[model samples]
Target: MAEQDTVRVGAFTVGMAEAEGWVRRYFDESRNREVAATGGRTRPYAYPVYDRFAAGGAESELSDGDLLAPSLLNASLGIRAVYNLQTLRPRLEKGLAAIPPTLTLTDAAARGTLASLLTDLFGVLDGPDPAVGLGLTTLSKILHRKRPLMIPLYDRRVKRCYCGDSGDHPVEPVSRSAPDGPFYAAVAAGIARDLAEQPVQWRYLASVAPADVSLLRVFDVVAWERGGTRDA
Candidate 1:
């Protein structure tokens, strides 16, 4: 899609409010309690593991890096018992393992630490699942965690604003070889950075989502809304 043809879409989800709101509500006290009470207790279990893996600490009897830890491997148990991501463990693991085990990003601004980490994970030509690459995975992770992380839309919604449908959730693929299409990830990062009022919290994210995953498809969702901040 041409830059001129693209228009923006307000973030939204479910028919109630913007995607951000939907996310906030989902994470709200009641929902969290409900999910937890009704066997939705995934975050509790996985978070500690995730934290340990992220910090390269001790989660098991062995050293943090001893076996790439279950969290590093994207163990479904974490998603199911802790984060409740409800997707392919390997795919999630790809994203988790792909991230660098650090906080600082080389070009923290252009890609942020975590986002850039995804780039490092998939941008490689010899990487494991070279299909989606780091870009798309990062975008996918951003959208999925936006509500939880509080970052604004990644920008594909903005990129294809008035351009019309490209027959997919994310219009483009993160990388050229990513199994998906468009490079929508490039679109998300590009447009989000162009904005002047982007959220502060999600600024630094080192993430990945294996190869061939659409990032969006991994969560089975799509963006929809009207207008947003014209100033920022």
Candidate 2:
């Protein structure tokens, strides 16, 4: 049979078969062995934040310490503490307030809402020095913790591996010049479509909550793994 044709989802174009292959590769033994070796050191600090929000806590409940700690330790992005939390906290609260309590990724309005929220959040720490602002990787991590299914962690590895030439570089913090909402939305929608069409691949993420394991995370894992191999 001829190779499957490509389909566009947001900013990503992926073949159905190719998407399945990527999903399968994530669950391959060698990959699991490597992930297992790391032993998920960040989960201890991260999962509580997810649980808090999921249990109906307000978005304002998420703190700077809660947001920055995991990213500094687990994201491997070399993020530094430069911004005053007092200055940054209110901006985060406003951005989080803009996000709806429930997000439906399939809806255009919902996607728009998310995109705007990200843009507002990214703009919070815009500064004279690029390195001084909240990094894109850290922003994604904070949003992902708040809504794992809707947001994917965008780091140097994932962007380089999945976003081709259009993706942002790891060194750049998200700003007006490098807004990331649309690209992330596209990738998330593409992954959601793949999972909807092929339920079997969903089984590969059996270890996590069914709600938490969306295409965004799958793509993150695949890209992170590929990027790691290339670095090695």
Tell me the lDDT of model 1 at 143.
24
Worst 10 residues of 1 by lDDT: 200-209
What is candidate 1's lDDT per residue for 110-207, written digit by digit as tens? Answer: 45553444444323323453432233333343323212221223333344442234443233332444532234334444434433232321221111
Per-residue CA lDDT of model 2 for 1-232, tens digit only, reads 3323542322334454555565555445455456556887622222223333333334455664555544433653233543443356666677666666455343423345545555555555454534354566776776666655555667666555444434433122242244344555444444455445544434444333234455455656555555555442
- Supply every candidate's count of residue pairs whose N, Cα or C atoms clash at under 3 angstroms: 26, 0
Which regions of candidate 1 deviate over 4 angstroms? 1-17, 39-107, 110-118, 124-188, 194-232
Global local distance difference test of model 1? 0.32
Q: Candidate 1, residue 82: CA error in Å?
A: 18
lDDT of each: 0.32, 0.49
Please give me the total number of clashing residue pairs in predicted model 1: 26
